[model samples]
Target: MQITNEHNEKMAKMTFSSVYPHYVAKVESKGRTKEELHQVIAWLTGFDDQKVKELIDEKATFDTFFKKAELNPNAELITGVICGYRIEEIDNPLTRKVRYLDKLVDELAKGRKMEKILRKA
Candidate 1:
């Protein structure tokens, strides 16, 4: 569920009102700061801080996150797309499930890969 540079570019062009919540969701779910989210947008879409802030202030939605996160066809990559520290790997079924869900939430927060995370399931 890798997001291509092209997809990231497309996301950057979306309206702020239409994309803000997604930004909020992504950052909040992953327990990341606005700065961290900014880094992710810069890494994945090449957007600067100003642009990332605009989106954060807009009316973001689940759809917006879905588009920005690029969930489809790149789910696998989401789990590995380092945020702050490395995503911890869980092997216990209960812990694994919880960790898996947390990781998925983290990825989706930024419109990330879902398949790689799913593979672990």
Candidate 2:
């Protein structure tokens, strides 16, 4: 599907809480822990465990979720394809943030080491 403005809008409006469970399930199924998943999330968006839980409890949309985030400076280093789109090539900033999280979760589920998944200088 073409990632038009409407598609970006739809993605931005997607509830982070609705997708959080699936992320937990995915990682756990692959023998990864929820703590590991949270670590990845913290590395990307700087949301602590408590804040994440609050967001989940409130069912915050991606828009609200990211707006509250102090995105990591290393986030732009998260490059690669996820969900068939090259994350670095994604023009919409919010959509890219969402995909960056997806990519981190994917890497965690795939057994990538934390050091590699959490990019650094």
Candidate 3:
């Protein structure tokens, strides 16, 4: 399904903190470490562990969270299917960014190698 602006706006208003635990649980359930989850987030958004925690503590919305992000130049390298949607086919910029994070977390939970997940240079 194509992502609509309404969907993007709704997702943008969602709290990153509210969604963080699910990401953590998904990875941990698959035997991955919280550190690995943080690593992927940091690699994608340029927020270190401390900054990530601070954003969570502040209850930052996805819009606010991504607004502060310095997305990696290699973010374009993140390509795959997520929730039945192809990442490269997503048209909404914000939704694409959100899906990028989702795809990364999914990859981490699925035990994809860190180098591959990070799209190593």
lDDT over C-alpha atoms for residue 9 of model 3? 88
lDDT of 2 at 57: 93
lDDT of each: 0.45, 0.93, 0.93
Residue 89 in model 2: lDDT: 87
Deviation in Å, model 3, residue 20 alpha carbon: 0.2
Predicted candidate 1 versus true structure: per-residue lDDT over 46-109, tens digit per residue: 4577755655676553235334542233223444434332334422222222223345546656
lDDT of 3 by residue, 1-121 (tens): 7777788789899999999999999999999999999999999999999999999999999999999999999999999899888999988777889999999999999989999999985
Cα distance off (Å), candidate 2, residue 110: 0.4
lDDT of 3: 0.93
